[model samples]
Target: MLVALIALITTVLYFVGGALLMQRLKLTAAGEPPGSRGLPRLFTLWGAAIVLHAFVLYAFLFGENADSLGVFTVVSLTAWVIAAFLFAWSFRHPIHVLGIVLLPFAGVTVALDMALSGVGPATPMDPSLRAHTLLALIAFSLFTIAAIQAAVLAIQTHMLQNHRPGGLIRALPPLSLMDTLLFHIIGWGFIFLTAALATGLFVLEDIFAQHLLQKVVFALIAWVMFAVLLFGRFQFGWRGRKAAHWTLAGFVWLFIAYIGSRMILARLLGV
Candidate 1:
């Protein structure tokens, strides 16, 4: 009951904040500086809700002899971390545009986790594996954010290409700046994912088990895709639509490798 309440409150705050931010954006043209009169207070409310949401997760998802991860747990935790990252990044960057989409998604996922009582089954673990798991979750969260950013960049690019640069387009950072931020995020997420994969291969006892092998294969493929995209960016100056496409593709494969199977098994098969 408490968890449900927390989730509900968090979802409401996210929706309210996102809606207000969108309304503010609608008030200005494409290139004009955004108004920021109430954003600080809005952020304060968001931060409080996020902190509470994290606490709820700690209470329910972690405790003595509790170390299980489920499909919903993974998604909810990743969204929580992404929200934290966005909250921090907002101080240094104009990424509130992302919050407009990210917050509502986070809210819905959190609420979904509560609704399904999806506190995934507990698993006994080796201490060493914990670090790898943390790295994997962080990598996933970062890429998730990158994917959303890439989506926004793609939309902005398309609008500009066809000369529809009003509304949200004007609210976005310059196209080159958006591209720069996207690659920077991808670079960091790639490094973290590489580390996670390396640790998994070296540390896990049986990464090639039948149920797990497909995940590893997909992860390796996603890693290679990101590597190729990064290499191309530096070597051939890949940018604009091509970069956005690669970013989304890399994220899709990563999602498949990490969350897709669990979702199928848990939500679909009731396993």
Candidate 2:
């Protein structure tokens, strides 16, 4: 019951933060400066939400009868990290508008985690395994953010190409700025992903017997995609739609590698 209450409060805070961000975006579209009044309040609210979210995670992970390392729990953790990173980044960048999507998503994840009360793995995670999992989740979260940024960049590109850059597009940072941010996100995600893969090698004893072959293959493919994209960006100056497409493609493969594989194992194979 206490957990439920905390989750509810966290959800409300997230939605409220999202609403505030949307309003800020609207004001920007209306010619108001992006750093106008009320930003500090929004930041305060978001910080409070993140704190409550951490409490919720603590309750689930450390409370009596706690053993929840399930999919939803992993996802909730990812959301929390993303929110925390974005909260810090927003102070220096025009990226708070991303909260319009991220905040609501975080709220929903919190609610789902509370309602579902996910179960933990059958066996306990060893230290190396835990380290690998943490790195992998961080990588996944960063890539998720990059994918969302790429989607927004696509919209900005479309609007610009059609000469209809008004509304939400007007509230976004300049195209070059957005492009640079997207690649930066991808670069960091790629680094974490590489580290995750390296750690995974130490954790896995037999990939084929453990049914991790597909996951590893898919992850490697994603790594290659991002590597190629980054190489192209520096070697050939790739940006705009091409970069967006590559970012999305890499995210898809990574999604399949982790989340999709888990779902299949749990639901279909009953593993």
TM-score top scorer:
2
Model 1 CA deviation exceeding 4 Å by range: 29-34, 119-125, 208-210, 268-271
Q: By TM-score, how accurate is candidate 2?
A: 0.94
Backbone collision count in every prediction? 1, 0
- In angstroms, the error of model 2 at 18 is 1.1
Which lDDT tens digits does candidate 1 get at residues 220-261? 999999999999999999998999999999999999988886
lDDT winner: 2
Where does the lowest 10-residue lDDT sum fall in candidate 2?
117-126
Count of clashes in candidate 2: 0
Could you tell me which residue pairs clash in candidate 1? 30-170
**Candidate 2 residue-wise lDDT, 5-27, digit = tens:** 98999999999999998888888
Please identify model 2 stretches exceeding 4 Å from their true place: 30-34, 65-68, 119-123
TM-score, per-candidate, Cα-based: 0.92, 0.94
Deviation of model 2 at 44, angstroms: 1.2
Model 1, total clashes: 1
